[model samples]
Target: MTASTEGATDTAATTDSGPTSLDTGSETGHQTTAGGDTDGSKPDLGAAPDEHCANPGPWPLPEAPLLELPRFVAHSYIDLDQIGWMTKFRSSVGHDYSDAFERCRSMKHYAYPIDEVDWGAVELYAPVAGEVIVVEQERYGSRVQLRSTLHPEIDFVLFHVDLMGPLAPGATIAAGELLGTHYGDQTYSDIAAATTVDGAWRLISWFELMTDDLLAVLQARGGISSPSDIIITQAERDAMALCCTNGQFDDPEELSDWVPLDAGNLAQPTRLGLATLDDDDGRLR
Candidate 1:
């Protein structure tokens, strides 16, 4: 039913261009079963010129997304030293500073502060193909919202971004497409995953959605054994009290001296629903 775009079938161009086009060759979606082939017969993929291949990225939509860092570098400030999940922080209104110990609370949130890194030259890639939802300009950058194509139930927001081009509603986005360029001397952004519950959109813990493989990749690049070592705990809070009168480690680097907790116990498993977490077929990694 879906028409194949011109040059879409060319494997060489597809690889060079990063699969900007989707192949709609079969009416039932030309995907193979877990085994080599359903009938135990290998599908003829011609040669490199005529080969047909599936898009590389996440699987079964976005349950356990294969995420690329905002920047192309294997590692960035997003390293274990800068990321935080389930950490207690002061809630401020209108960007006003508040008491850290008295106003601190724990909520599911992820923060990556790439303040020292130069991201102005890097292109931001769309984590998934989705419709543009909201666009807002901020002091340091622009905030763009996209309705996830993989999961209509979830909404994704990218803060502190400079869009590559104008993206209006109803426009189709391709996975791995360059959404925009990030520009800033001191840049930081939060990628939040929200879902509607009881008719209201609430922030959900994405820490669990981060797959073990991805975590290992990050850990290797971050020069740490586990990403979970960054998760703040009551003991970390006590350590902060020893240094600061207010008991707050405003700079994440302050906690670098603390020992990394048992990563295996801290990591939350992926929540599987309609989608699966299998890449054993060696087709979708």
Candidate 2:
């Protein structure tokens, strides 16, 4: 449980020689200074303080899936903008470029907005039924990493973890399981990069939750109006079950066939294409 450190008042001697005059304000028990303007009244220097409140318990865990495993992971980024561009450019071009690039790729640093530290105050959950892969606690920040066999190609990383205590490495965890809470100088409320459409950085996990077809079902029914909504029809659920049971299709083009239900005459699935990630100089942007 987290504990709040509030309500404590410091007792400092205003004067060593004389009795200080006290002024009571409009509200009961709340006092202000006399001769002070109504617009700017000084707060009461002395008052019985309220006790600190205990932290609330953890949130209830989500139900597990019967067939396909769920994969959960939190995301965060360093405030690169705080550092000078020359430093960043030097780091990128220096002999340590390989190490820097590896770190950038592992954490997707380029995709992260330099202006803000994402996922600061929010709690992240496990994406899949996997064992804790890594746990490191040092001055930089605390980290709780997990891996699941459900998705071999993907490695779920939850960085910038702030926990009550150090989580043990190699611990077994289920989907929707509590990995850790947000910590350090980073937070979810940080302002997004200048180039981003929204001024606020997104605290959402990057891992994909549902297949493209299941997403199509939700889209056709207009069920997923918000990011929080996960409602789907029985047929959509059945399609997902078949996909997981039969194992994902080998051919990328044939993957659409795994979708069990068809929303006849529905609009074509939205296409999201990516352009080159390079500039005029043929270097990564």
Candidate 3:
């Protein structure tokens, strides 16, 4: 996750603590500001009430689809334990997986069953119309990690990838463009509090402002209705259900807050920093 410059200061006093002063002088010449005073004379910065600080206000939601249609369809969802809690909360709050699986099974569309691995070739495509933000070529022994800024308000993260070579940063890409391929042993692991059926590996990706629209879609589709319901498969549903039931998912509010706006529609690429996988080698365990 990238850092935001809005709240980057060190000594900005919050409502709960009042104005905080930073001493630039030596230890012997240290000075202090009273909790209420910005200057020595004024009782406060004339700052708004505490509620202003407590509730930053509702975040703006995107109108049109932030990401292009036919987005890179994952054969399965990333195991819940591999991502932040908010992602898990988003998946759980809007949908019931077990019930969805039963419904899918009744309809005989359960080709991708739990306890089985998706050995089928995994496809990779761009999530939005933007440039490559960052690409890490050597992180996972030929795997590449791509980060792109789809819009001024949204950042997209694609990992567990196998690319041809290093993609220059700032190279623009259209939505649904072939970004890379998926590579790894087609088995998952059962470590770090995440559940695994037999041995199917999971992948990790991050999204900023793009989630609200995705959530809205999932909600409209009855929250993970089935493996073939939309983007997720049956195995993915079972894995998330198990992870949520076992307390492996992160907090919902935090995840919801991290979503950014899908403005700008920028197409820039950045360098991949550290690659965070479920296990050390992008395997289950």
Candidate 4:
């Protein structure tokens, strides 16, 4: 599907800490068109994807309540190769397949499933503590972008979502603060995060960062661990390997703040970065 924009009022909010920083030293430039629509008429900053899924695996609904931590699923690059997480497609029907995939990869688009039975507009919370920088509206849709003050180079953009109650292009928002919700039959929303590097916006993979964060929290959520248990399953390793690709990540061990599954009986090492949103004074530790 295509992207459009709508109008919104500006507001302000406090910021929080996540690994929101980006390597701003790259030479590529990124731009988002007004109304969040980019077509053949505009210069190609990069082709953005529709969604990112971070859920480790699906859960039986009746048993979901028994799960300690929330399961993550967002828009992610579809692994056509079936061998790893990164996209290896080199050709398509007629378009520049490799180029398009790379562009989509760079954007790190996130798509989460909406409850079809009760899926309508609901409030969106600030994923980070940051200030509103740009609110763009077009004839068909709208977008709001935020820049984390704590990590000035990191930016978050919510697409096809409306703003409500006096929000606009210059507001500051606290992490988990309310933003308006979807107003139509759409099943999902899109969120794109990037960091400005060398004057260009570089997208970071949200899967590793998000999954690792959830792992940290879940490790402490329940009392279900054995001193000799194998923490990192082979499936989890493949998923992590797939989620991180290109120059984005060479080794999962090198990923920042990542908690290794096997750490020699280190009790809940992942929880090291777990912190409450209200505890804004501390970083995700």
Candidate 5:
């Protein structure tokens, strides 16, 4: 939960200095799912090649997780862009890089689910089975830090939520189990995942962990057109410099610092999994 936070939730105030050091995964020769990804020809996410990781992730977890959350604008960045989070950002003080680049980390992991059901009426469920290791109280709500049994190194959390019932350390939860509702009467929402990779903290997109079947379910419901809907790679974000420096959009010509998702008028779908290509020649791309 964030203290005095509005849109997205976080306990610690993020600094430009960065959290310890973010492992962009560039060093691991981070595996991409498809051959086209190797040449940057395909936009995809690499599966952490494990015999089986359920979901492999090493995003940073606070020695304790630990901010006012930004007034959330929308469900997914795509919808926020396609649909809009206008009411919140219009009244913005500093969220979404509106202020002095305060908490990019929060933004990095922040996700407003795009499910069409009534948000207020819906009960939040655990995306995967795990144990409630710690529940941190934030001004916006409770941050349930769930350590996945399937992927022990990865920690999952649904920010700004009120659990269906009380939970304590070691309390077990199964996938799709009722966690709770978004913190009572909350205006904004988000879900975040993290893990310690290379003994360092890295924030990851929660969508990366969902099974293919689960993703298919969401796709069929029109919640997400594709896995790429909610994913933005660290390498991609840095290359785009998605946020403003020192919190200032600074550019007189630009009204906001956020990069428009459809700025490229993409004809091909951006995806998070690798694609195997068939080639007559030896070219990887």
Candidate 6:
């Protein structure tokens, strides 16, 4: 639900208190480009024996993170604007990654935590220094895409933002620079990254490329303790049954689409987060 729709209160409502579950409907035509494995039949979910599964390259790729992880939000916790409670990968609380890159792909990208702060109180910043290749203006807001200067294949994406500068295909951007203000009505920031592989864009959590110091900031502000605590591996996510309907990638169900953020309690009977979750008990939808 990070990509705010104009009026989807029915499906995008805050049924509970963690992150808003989504109902993409036709509003997400912009993000409908999930390729590689969208044949309606769910992936093996096991070890992904087939070859079509997404290929996640080495972590912290070289020339990677050409710049430090830029701060996306400008709010401070000392001011009572609690900007925490972000959902990790394979957790469908943001956009639907039900059918991401390849069979073994986790369509999910990280949603930067911005809970309880005024909508535009937080300013957005570029997390990487690269060349702007795509700048899109949508009904709700603007989105920008940048390719790494060092590694052209790796792309950094930011959605649901009102761009700050005159960005075009050939423009250059430095990490930590102001991208724009937090647009729309959602509580968090959305960043879904991908890499070009075999003529297709394969989903890859950009945070996986973060330096140790960068990840430490995530651990300090949110409920995260370790890298594994946040990232939902293919096997772990499949076991949780956090999937979407055959063709419905946007209309996320409470249990089916979203994964719980209980960092260490993977096998707990019920899932929990920083705040109290609804009594839904997280039954597989």
lDDT of 4 by residue, 1-285 (tens): 111111110111223432232221111213333333355344433322211323111111011011122223222221111111111111010111011012212232322222232223445556666788766652223556776656555666665555666677568987667677643333234455554333323344333334444434424533213311212322232233222221122123222222223334233222121111111110100
Query: What are the lDDT scores of the predictions, listed in order?
Result: 0.35, 0.27, 0.27, 0.33, 0.38, 0.43
Model 3 — which ten-residue stretch has the worst lDDT? Answer: 100-109
* lDDT (Cα, tens digit) per residue for candidate 2, span 1-285: 121112111111123321111110000111224345577754443322211112211111111122332323222222222211111111111111111101110111111222233434345456456666556553334545454546532334444456645567568877666655455332111111101011111111131344454344335544233222322222232233211101111112111211112234233222211101110001110
Relative to the true structure, candidate 1 reaches a TM of 0.44
RMSD of each: 19.8, 25.3, 18.1, 18.1, 16.6, 12.9
TM-score order of candidates, top first: 6, 5, 1, 4, 3, 2
TM-score of predicted model 5?
A: 0.49
lDDT for model 5 comes to 0.38
Candidate 1 lDDT over 1-285, as tens digits, reads: 132332121111122312211211111112323334766765453332111223221111101122332221121212343332222221110111111111111212323323344445445666556776656565556656665666665555555577778876567766557777654434433444444432323333334345465556656544345434444443343233221112121222322322222343333212111101010000100
Q: Model 6 over residues 117-210: C-alpha lDDT tens digits?
A: 5656567777767787667664445657676665555666666577766778778877677777766453244565555333323456555666
Cα lDDT tens digits for candidate 5, 1-285 = 122212222222333422221212111112222345555564443432221323322222122222211211112212232221111111111223211112221233322323343445446677667777667665655667666676666665565666667877678977677767655333444454555433434445455555566556445545356545555433443344322222222222122212223334223221211101010000100
Residue pairs that clash (backbone atoms under 3 angstroms), model 1: 164-180
Best candidate, TM-score: 6
Clash statistics: count for each candidate: 1, 9, 23, 37, 29, 2
Give each model a TM-score: 0.44, 0.30, 0.33, 0.41, 0.49, 0.57
Which candidate would rank higher by TM-score, 1 or 3? 1
Worst 10 residues of 2 by lDDT: 276-285
Model 3 C-alpha lDDT per residue in residues 112-173, reported as the tens digit of each score = 11223332234456655655544544343232222333332223344445554566666776
Give me the overall lDDT of model 4: 0.33
Strongest candidate by lDDT:
6
Model 2 lDDT, residue 233, Cα: 24
Worst 10 residues of 5 by lDDT: 276-285
